[model samples]
Target: MPAPATPEAPAGWDFSDVVGSDSSLRRFLHGLPGVDQVGAEARAAQLGTRSIKTTAKAFALDLAIRMVDLTTLEGQDTPGKVRALAAKAMRPDPSDPTCPPAAAVCVYPDMVADVKQVLGDSGVKVASVATAFPSGRAALDVKLADTRDAVAAGADEIDMVIDRGAFLSGRYLQVFEEIVAVREACTAADGREAHLKVIFETGELQTLDNVRRASWLAMMAGGHFIKTSTGKVQPAATLPVTLVMLEAVRDFREATGQMVGVKPAGGIRSSKDAIKYLVMVNEVAGADWLDPDWFRFGASTLLNDLLMQRTKMTTGRYSGPDYFTLD
Candidate 1:
């Protein structure tokens, strides 16, 4: 049995356990076999009615190029780091024209001001990872406050990590509650809802089924976006894992008519990989979500490849990724 919808997890609660009193495990298990075929072709056929104007050919490069503006470019990546990101965002280099369509420039909460300044008038949003990021182990108040602070700092979006320890311990309800609360905390900031992307660190979860379940859990808990990995873990993003996630997104849409977003982070080092993801998204989600609004890639080094590919397609010659550093 899972804990009721009160924002509290026992000192040590367990959710995925069949051997526990406080958890959604029994329920989850009972419902497992039903979702097993979520990635099947039959599921895709169901999505035909949900199709929008999205297609890989049209939106692959755009989504691939929408840089998350990782603030880690500089060591003490504080407000100054955000400014530096903005500078890089605004720099006009002949090698990389059009700049990254400026997906939310990710930064620490404290640097929201600098990111805002750097991205001024460009419509690029600012996203901040919070709530003890890469590890959601913290006092609820502390985590909520951190998320609040980020939004107060002008973060247009929030990326938060779940407590893997708790989740792995069979505590699905706790994970669910924490994410919901953080979502609330983010929305409370800026006197409106700031977008929230929940990072599941699927690599740590260790199975495509768990990844799919986690994706569903996040969506059910109100995550506007279900993201993979924190980019801090190895085996960040993989085709099989992402295929599972997109398949979940497709099912959730069929069940609720809600279209949540998908972001694959970590270790995607080349444009070709991005294109492959694009292929998956198109094949899975159909053509309606080809816009940058619903899709994103968390990458620091993938941009040059996207540019190179786009350039090659236009100019009919291969350009090295280093071409971005030149003119």
Candidate 2:
């Protein structure tokens, strides 16, 4: 028998627009408007000045809490560590039950089982960093195995790092194909497939132009979400870099009628900073992207800051770091 037919693209959508010969891909990416670095930075800085207060502040705080991908990706991470992280994710503020739980708990592939066991049926998701996470230097087979193992271990989402080496070397097609392959590897044996978030590690990509191209490349290659960084680099995530990514997702949705998510990991630690990011999302991607489903913060300490601020809002006083559990 012939091979099974692949599912059709969404109505009025065409994958051909993005997939093509190497030359065509280059032309397409190059044809994209060049990034005005100064202008982009100025805009991000300007948006950062917008002051959210009172009721709006409260709303944004809660939304930010829910959008967090409570993360712990470290050489020292253990099952005990992951379990503690999951507990914090389930109840971010021990003093107040009204504070919403984070959207997901992110971990390394080997720890997904522990996180799942801790979370049980609380509806919090488990996100795994795979595909030779933090460094996409492994063989393709190893990467795929890494992704499959995470999914089999019950990860609801997979954050895969793209081959920046291939991308910077002008091997755009290789990078795109890698994303597609890893996305496929997210499938579970029972026919379920975890959502795939492709990390561009824009810090190493070196230019806003490169960031824009990588964003489009990942989206075109079937990444359910295009992420800013892997949280291990110098400039893991920045307002300007994330602004460029948000624009890509917004534009992709306008053209394809398919909305892809965006996650900005690393460097975002304060409730104030998180709110500023929320403002950027609203202005750049519109209210549609404000929800946890479309946007996520890949953070570890960000949750605690949000909790402290949340307590301040509720009790009219700032709670020290001691108030929250140390995960």
lDDT leader: 2
The ten-residue window of minimal lDDT in model 2 covers: 1-10
| lDDT per residue as tens, model 2, 85-190 | 9998998876688999999999999999999999999999999999998999999999999999999999999999999999999999999888989999999999
- In model 1, the clashing pairs are 15-170, 15-171, 15-172, 16-170, 52-288, 53-287, 53-288, 54-287, 54-288, 54-290
lDDT of 1 by residue, 11-69 (tens): 22333343243345436533543333334434433433342243443355655666444
Steric clash count of candidate 1:
10
Counting only residues 3 or more apart in sequence or on different chains, how many pairs clash (N, Cα, C under 3 Å) in candidate 2?
0
Q: What C-alpha lDDT does candidate 1 achieve relative to the native structure?
A: 0.69
Give the C-alpha miss distance for residue 139 in model 1, angstroms: 1.6
lDDT assessment of candidate 2: 0.90
> Which window of ten consecutive residues has the lowest lDDT sum in model 1?
1-10
